[model samples]
Every structure is written in C-alpha cells, then in structure tokens.
Target: MNDDSRKAGGADQDPFFMRDPEKLAANLARTIEEAGKAAGFWSRARESGMVSDSSFDPFADMLRVFSALGQYWFSEPSRSFEAQTRLFTAYMGVWMRSMQELTGQAEPDKPEAKRPDKRFHDPEWVQNPFFSSLRQIYEVTARWAEELVERADTLDDLTRLKARFYVRQIIDAMAPTNFVVTNPAVLRETLKSNGDNLVRGMQMFAEDLREGGGIPRLRQSDLGAFEVGENLATTPGKVVARNDLAEIIQYAPSTGKVLKRPLLIVPPWINKFYILDLNEKRSFIRWAVSQGHTVFVISWANPDERHRDKDWDAYIGEGIEFALDTIKARTGEDEVNAIGYCVGGTLLSAALALMAETGDQRIASATLLTTQVDFADAGDLKVFIDEEQLQALEEAMERKGYLEGGRIAMAFNMLRARDLIWPYVVNNYMRGEPPLPFDMLYWNSDSTNLAAANHSYYLRNCYLENNLARGRAELRGRKLRLSSVKIPIFNLATADDHIAPALSVYNGSRLFGGPVEFVLSGSGHIAGVVNPPAQRKYRYWIGEVHEEGFERWLETAEETEGSWWPHWQQWIEAQGNETVAARSFGPDEEALDDAPGKYVRKRV
Candidate 1:
C-alpha cells in the first residue's frame, strides 16, 4: 500500500486497522469453519429434539404482521397498487435528486425538514451519490412499510401495534449502514485495513456466538473493566441479612445524624441491585446514605432452575417483608419509608396491598419510581405480550425452569435497535472495535435470570391480563386490590420512558386509594430515576394529578431545574425529619457478606 493508503488506513482513522493479508485470510477461513460448526450444532440439537422447530423460526408476531398485510393487499388490487405507487413515487424523487446532483443542477436537501437520524450523519452518506440514494431508498421503503400497517384498518389495535413495532425492527435491520458495501465508514475501514477489520470482526462474531451458546450476544461494554464490588458497586455497606431470594445490604451512614425512619430500596430482580450503587459518583445508595437517611437495599439472588417455583409470594415474603423485619430488628424502628424501582416498584405495590389486607403497617410511606400498576398502556414492551406469545414464553420457561436473562435484555435493546443493537453490531463486529467502558451499559449487560413461576406470574398478571389494575391480581391465595392500600404514596414517572409510559404511570397513580403525589422526571427509565443532584442535569415537574390526563397536568405543573434527588429527599424528610445517632451492623449481628453481596455476583 502507498503512503496515501497508509494515511487513509491509519490507526487514528480506524482503531482496528492492521496490515496482514495472510492473517486476514486465515481468520476468515477459521470464522467460516466456526459458522459451519455452529450450524451443525444447532441442526443436531433440533434433530435430537433438544430444541423445538418453533425456536428456529422467526418471531411469530412478524409472520402475523405479513399475514395481516397480505390479507389487506389481497382484499383489493388497488390497495396493493396504491402502496406500490407511493413507494415508486418516493423512488422517483430519489432518482431525480441523484440525477440533478450528478449534473450539478441539484439544490441542497432540506436537512431540518428531514427526520433526525444519527446513522446518516456521516458526510459521505450525503456527499456520495451512491450512499445518498441508498439512504433515501431505505428511508422511503421503511416509511412505506409503516404506512401499510397504519392503513390496514381490518387489523385490531394490538395486532396493528405489533405490526408497526415488528415492521420497524425489520426496516432497522435492513438499514444500509448495517451492511459493509453500503456503509461508507465500514467500507473505508475495510479498505484501510486490507479486509483486516472484517477478519477481526468475524473472529469477534464467532467468539460472541460461542459465548452466547449458539446465539449472538453482542458485547455492550468492555466487561473486563468493571466488576460488581471492585469498581462498579463500590458503595460502603454490609450484608445484614440474607434469605433464599435476596440479601439486604444496610449501607453505612455518611452523616452523623440519620433519619429515625430507615429507608429500604427494592430494586428490580431482572437486573442486579447495583444499578443504584454503580459507582461513588453515580451511586444512589451512597447518595441516599449521605442525605441523613439509613439506606437498606435489597440485592436479589440471581435465580437458577432450583428457584423455579419461587413466585411473587416468595419474593414479597422472603424479599421485601424480610428486609422490613431486618430493618426493625437492627434499627428498632417499625415505620420505615420505602422506594421501589421498575418491577420492584410493581412488586412492592402488590405487597403493600397484601400488607394492608393483613393489617401489617411496617411501611409508613411509599415511593414508586417509574412503576406501572396499570399495564394497559405499558409502552412498546406490550408488543411482546399476547396470548400466543405468553404461552410460548411459558412453555420455554418451563423447559429451562427459568427464562434466560438475555431474552429480556434483547427485547429492551430491540425497542431502540438503531441505538443499541445495530450501533453495537457495526462498531463491535463491522469495525472490530471494542465498546467503551460505561457503568450504565455494564449494569445493563449484567442480566439476571427470572425464576419460572415468578416470571410467568409477572407476565400474565402484569403484562398480558393487566390484572393488578383491575383488582384481579392474587397473591398467597388472596385477591389483592390496589385501592385497599391507603398510604402516603409518591408516584414518579419519566417523560421519555419506553418500558413504562408516563401517561400509564399517571393513570396508575389514581388507582391507589391514598393521597398520591405524582412527579414527572426528565429522562428515560434508568437515567431519570438514578439522576443525582450533583449532576444538575434534567428537570422534573410536580403537580396535582389531573383528572383530564398527564399531558394536561404537564401544562399546569411546576417545572424545577436539576435532578429530582433533592426534591425526593425533602419529601421523605417531610414524612418525618426526626434524626438519631447513626446506626451500623453491630458486632453481634451476623454478617453474611459485604455490600454488593454475593447474590449480585452470581452470573446467569
């Protein structure tokens, strides 16, 4: 290669740049052999009845979408003609633009009028005629496909929602940026490295497939850089209690005077509890401790097949209730304030109902962060929940005795594939580059398997049936009603949350038979909730719950600058600001482990 080629292929331009044609060919051959081996392994597993045929098929919802589209198109010839004409018209515009550009007669495209897309941000995507046309073609086709689903009036609301979601996934997967030939960046890297990038990418692909046990598990972060207690979950605390379902960590006080009423945090079992204790800078646990409150976080056990029968009853009884009992024992306080995030918040809400029924009043006030008791409008996550899909999921979970953690991770990733999946694919596989070490991404990648009974109940009652909202949800042979739980409740919802919509959370706030304070935070699920006052990023809104709707309430709500952490602190303090000398795990108390306990360290 000449000096110009070397300059183009420099390490500064492409991190994975290397000049070794022999090694590239060898790596390519090995990758091909690995692919063949993986195919054979899957084929043999299927033949042996270890894997079902349906497992090999694409998502059934995708097929249902095509079926619906086919019915719509075949119902009338002009319907199909109209769709084709629309697509062709879009193509004609692209072709004319390309020709105009080629002849130096084209006017600049209206960038502001176009949809904001990160994938097409590369200058070559617009400057190069070939790539510009390809980008236009993909965008046009994607829009057309979505329009067909929207126009299919015969399909029901749920089916149409699923169709639109699946259609987006399909279109996203087919984006020009995902392919080597069409992506200028990847193509440039390929040329610069003399196919070395592809060779390394293939190797990485094979490794991921191997690690995932035949499934491609793309690395979201540099896993080697972060560990649970060492760097990520480095909060100072002690495991004061351990049960089959969880370990209760009582965080060491950062202040001399702590709140008399200790605070217990219930985190989602789907992922590690350390999300709240990621690092010193971002650790909510540490921050809460510093805010003159005794913090106790539930570190849920990463369950396996042995925990298959552990249901919501077990989680509540052996998890939340157990923590309450422990807090009372250690602190000599019965009235403890509590906060729950995501599914943990949902589980806590149910437990509160159960507790109300039994006349157990250990909890004085409740704070639910981005929780949805009513799943009617549970955002895009609902697309994966239907009768057929639920049954399939149940059967699969039954076989393994637990649902694979990666399944949940992949579902969330798909909801934003353009950001999560494809970007990682292009970066890690296409470019043969390692993902940057990020604490949040590290926590996201660290998934936890869900016990069969617990997971099944959550899906059916919460997602599919929307039982909790309707007062039909049951726990421990008793029907639990949200209205029965009359306690001071703080309900928080993120404006841009995808898993739990802000409007759904707003509606849920009305379900609780209590004085509810609904707060709207500025970002999505994790960032919005974990936001610290120190960061001074993102705004929050507080307002009276409007009978009209969330949007109406937003119009009249009081907007406050910076993180919601300080506001929440003030609210909790309002509950009861009386403080006492800080408490710690006594020498006599049995300590199972340090903070960021063993349960979180258990890999799925």
Candidate 2:
C-alpha cells in the first residue's frame, strides 16, 4: 500500500482481513506483536500521562480528557447512533413481549413489534426472536461500549478518535450480516454459489490492494458500466470556452426561445462540475435547458500537483470571473443569473460582494444550493476542521501538493458509517455482489482533488477563522463583506445534509441582503438537490425567513409535495425577465474538446 493510503487510516489492510484462515493466522501473530507495543504505550501513558517516560500531572491529564471529549462530541459520532440504539432497544423489548405472548404469559394488549431501523426491518430478523434478540444484544453492547468510550476521562483526543473509529469498525464488522455463520443471506448465497462469492471477494481485495491503495469502495462491475459523457454529464453541449482553471459548457437549448439572461452554474471546484449535469433525467443542466433557460455549466479542471499553488483568489479570477466573461460575451447579455453549489456558492457570494464593492454588475440574480456562507455550524464536517486537524491536514497537503479525492471520501464515509461504509463492506467485500450502478454513486466515487494552497487558504480563512461571515474576508486585494451581496437570492437546503446541515444553510440565507426564498427539501446533501420533478418522492417546505428559529419554522411551515426545482425555476423566471431568441452553445469559443472536456477525465 502507498504511504498516502496508510495515512488515510489504512483501509487497504482490510479491516476484515481475518476472515481467511491463513490470513487470520498471520494477523494473529502480528496482533500479538502489535499488542505488546500497544500495552507498553498504554502503560506508559497511563502512569506518566505521556507516551514517553515522564512524571504524571493530574492537571495535564484533565486537559487531555477535556480535549478528547471535545473531539468526540464535535465529530457527531452519535448523530446516527441514537436512531440505531433506539431501534435495537425497541426490537429487544418487542422480542421480550413476543416471547411472553408465545408462552401464553402476555400482559395487556399492545401494538405489534417493529425494528428500530428500517434497513434492518428484515422480516426474517423479526420472525425469529432468538436471532432478533441476538442482534439487539450485540447492538446494546456496542452502544454501551460507545458510551464508555465517550465517558473515558484519561484518553487524549487523538487516542479517543482512533479508539472510537476502531470500536465502531469492530462492532460493525461483528454484525451478523457480515458473516455466513451469522447472516442467513450470506449462508444462502454461499450454499448457492458454493463459496465462489468468497473467491471473488478475495480477488477484489487483491485488486483493490493493487490499485486504489487497498480500499475497494465498489465492485468493478458497478464501475464498468458508466463513463463521463456517455453516461453522466451526457447532456449534449459544447465546451464553448476553455482556460487553465475551467471549461464553459453551453448546453443545447431544449426550448424554442431561451431566456435573455443565461444561467452560469458555478460548482465547487473541489469536485468536477458535471454534478449539475449528471445525466439526462437528473441533470440540473438539462432541466434548466428544458425550462427555456440558456444553461452554462463550468467544468473545473481536476487539479494535480501542477495546481498546488492555485489559491482561492485564483479560482475567483480564473474560474468564476472567466466563466462570467464568457457568458456575457456569448449571450450579449450584460447580466446573467448565477447558481453556485457547495463551495462554489461561497466563492460566488464572495465574488458578488467584491463586485458590489467595486461597482461591477455582471450578475443579474443568484441562487445558492446546499451551500454554506456561515461556518459556525457547518455540521458534523466541522469535527475534522479544528486547529490541530487542519494543521495536520496542511502538512499532508504540503507533501502531496493537493489533497487526494479519496481522502476526502474517507472522511465523509466516516461521518455516516452505517449508510456509506459498512453496507459497501458487505456488498463489495463479503457478499461479492456488485453495487447498483446508481448515477449519484458513480459521481460520488469519481472524486477530484483540492490544491494545497486553495484548500489551505479555504480551511484557514473560511472554516477555521469563520472570517467570511464576519465580513473580514479579502478578495482580489479588496476587503469584502458577504452581506454586500444585495441581489435577489433563492437558497435551497436539504433537511438531512450532514456536510452542510439545513440550519447552516439557513444561517447563510440570513447573510444575504435581498429578498430571500429559503426552501427546506427532504432527503440529503446530493440526492435532495438533484431531485427532479418526476421522482415525486420527497417533500419540501418554504416559510418566511423571519426572526423565528429554524426549528420554529419547521414546526409551523406546511410541506409541499414533490421537487423544489419547479419553485426554483419560478423564482428564476421572475428574476430573469422574459424569454428571448434561442442560442445553442455557439461553436466552441476556442474549442479545446467536447462538453465533458479533458478536465472531467483527469483522475488521480
């Protein structure tokens, strides 16, 4: 495994490597050797309050404990734990009651039993109380262990962080679903496939060890089916303009006549821009085009070591400004409605603020989606954003020039261990089943790097300092206030976004200095925003952004069924004025390649 991958928690070693008898024997020997060293370290640390020999200090010990507690609580490890705990606790109680019923020793009448977590609501899990009780007992024990770790007063933050991650991983791996001995599905599949699943899984493990630094996220079959322009970002368009930082994609008009003010989408450069143009049905770019709006999506260059020196200001000048210039020149429209997602919105907002200060009026209106301008409560992601972590990250970035996209993916997967981590562990490594070829997952697995300077400046200024919200941020040699962005703005926040919580997004809306329409949509970060009107799956709510709190707004607001895309389009239509002559991406403004462009294809 590469040194970089080892630094990323060493998933390449395969947390479940012991499943093979030979590997288990080898691991057992290694564990014995490592355990002795660990015991020595623990004994030294416990007695002396230092890993190296030193006199122990009670005050120092207390401080270490406090720091650890801060890291644990801040990381939001229990965000989903509570739900799982409740489900298991409830399931155990239900089984107890059901047993009493079966014995004809039941008490008064009550409702039927149900699993706490819907994913584990396997009918078979409930049909047999013995198995159900087993799971519940394991879950209860795991929760107790988590509580014990959280309450530990001796461990430092780094120690606790490692402990918590390992504990959760150990517990998650021990779950019945992970092994044929415990899991019915695995047992059945094993009998049917004659242990061939294990063979494939081992092969996958070997291949992942060979390629992606030992961590295999999805089955190769899942990846084999999709490509960038052919599958995702498939919407027909031309790379009308190209520069060092970004490629401007002016999509083909899906309407007879398009709106006068074209829309230029500024997506987070930390990722490829095609997230807006994922596919035909879900692609926001195609949707905008069909809405009779001239859509232009910026495809950011996938940065390498070459882009290590490219800072945040470079993105503003070359990324946003460069695209803005192209949109104006092509459409002959002086002002264009701009939409920014994630960090892109943060930059666009800064740009608008700078422009407002400098008397530049290139933007007609603005829409910020699932993005944050305020860093105070940037959600569980903040757990890894504190001073020590940032400094360590900076050191790593300095060595690499840019932070690998895989590293970022690991952090996010950690945030939602159950949803993002363990299921894939089972599917790709245990069951040997290929993951579904979902479009969003494809985009998710396909990640892009953050340049060292770009990321460090952002981490220090925006996340660490919280300077942007304080109006202390400087851009293009000018001090700027974010609130100076007085353009009419529409903001969308997904209810379950872990990266940028709905409330955080709401707080950013308060920073805007114009008419604000804040809509709270259902689902999570990416899925919530990508929702098309056709899904008709999740609901959204829009209440007046009053002095009332976000919780108060939720309590009082009425939810409207279906996607917020229509509502957003309505707002844009009103702000963009009337429709004009249709214009397909005029022949590539200095064409480099096609719509998906060279930048989208660049991978680490």
Best by TM-score: 1
TM-score for each candidate, following the candidate numbering: 0.94, 0.79
Q: What is the C-alpha lDDT of each candidate?
A: 0.85, 0.73
**What lDDT does model 1 reach?**
0.85
Off by over 4 Å in 2: 1-115, 118-124, 127-130, 143-174, 191-194, 214-221, 585-590
TM-score of 1: 0.94
Worst 10 residues of 2 by lDDT: 49-58
Deviation (Å) of 477 in candidate 2: 3.1
lDDT, candidate 1, at 465: 93
Question: For residues 275-358, what per-residue lDDT tens digits would candidate 2 score against the true structure?
Answer: 778888788788888988888888888887888999878888888889888887788888889999998988888888888999
Compose the digit string of candidate 1's lDDT tens values, residues 1-604: 3335647767655433455668657766765775676576556655765445474234766887689878988789998899889999999998998899888898635333547888888876676677778888888899898899888989987878888888899999999999987898998887666666776777777777666555567799998999888998898888989988889999888888999999999999888888888888888888899988899999988988899999999999999999999998889998999999999999999999999989999999999999999998887888888887888888888887888777778888888888889999999888989899998998898888899999989999999999999999999778889999898999999988988899999999999998899999999989998898889899999999868987799899999999988888888988899999999667676687888789889775
Tell me how far the alpha carbon of residue 494 in candidate 1 is from the true structure, in angstroms, after superposition.
0.8
* Model 1 bad stretches (over 4 Å): 1-31, 37-58, 108-114, 587-590
